[model samples]
Target: MAQAATITIGSKVRVLRVRDRIPADLVEALKADPTGTVTGFRTVDGQGIGLEVDLGAGKGAWFFDDEVTLA
Candidate 1:
């Protein structure tokens, strides 16, 4: 089994699934969230990517990766 890869925003990534593949609505939902405070970007296992987001209303190291593929 493949290990879960860590992803972050602004980590240079690409979209893997299409509108029909996953659902156009789903994609839109993810886009709705704003990239606030999320400054840096990073990846894990090269499977997916993510971004280091601001810890707003939360704690500990956190990130947000809207894209599904690597950039």
Candidate 2:
């Protein structure tokens, strides 16, 4: 399988859009301002591809490669 585009740690990323795969509760908050910093990688289905972004002010969210972009 081809690898998805992933943001590097400490890089800034913007939430382009949230997918149905994301939990409903997190969708709105994640898209509120549409910006965050890549803090780390998260595991999903045994793959360390999920991107962890910190939105600052103690707020943060994790999104897959397709949900965010370099900002």
Candidate 3:
């Protein structure tokens, strides 16, 4: 995991398009239903950070919380 950074709502985050895992779909789900609980995040070269979001109630998912803006 790279150095953690601060992220806030309304930020433009990237989508980790993992095959059959969690792609843009998951990202949309998060936007639709943001539980406010950050599941996972990691930084990558050029690609920015990847985020795994657990939407709670077994409705978990993953995406790239890349362009997240800190409040």
The best candidate by lDDT is 2
- The segments of candidate 2 whose C-alpha lies over 4 angstroms from its true place after superposition are 1-6, 21-32
Ranking by TM-score: 2, 3, 1
Question: What does candidate 2's lDDT look like per residue over 2-71, in tens digits?
Answer: 3334457988888887665766545666657778889888877785477889887677778778777889
lDDT of 3: 0.48
lDDT per residue (tens digit) for residues 1-71 in model 3 = 23235543333333333434446765576567555455566555676665555555566554455322222
Off by over 4 Å in 3: 1-4, 8-32, 43-46, 66-71
Choose 1 or 3, whichever is better by TM-score.
3
Cα displacement (Å) at residue 43, model 2: 2.3
> Model 1's lDDT to the true fold?
0.40
Error of 1 at 61 (Å): 2.4
Question: What TM-score would every model get versus the actual structure?
Answer: 0.31, 0.71, 0.41
Least accurate stretch of 10 residues (summed lDDT) in model 2? Answer: 1-10
Worst 10 residues of 1 by lDDT: 1-10
Top TM-score prediction, candidate number: 2
Kindly report the root-mean-square deviation of model 2 from the true structure over all alpha carbons.
Answer: 3.1
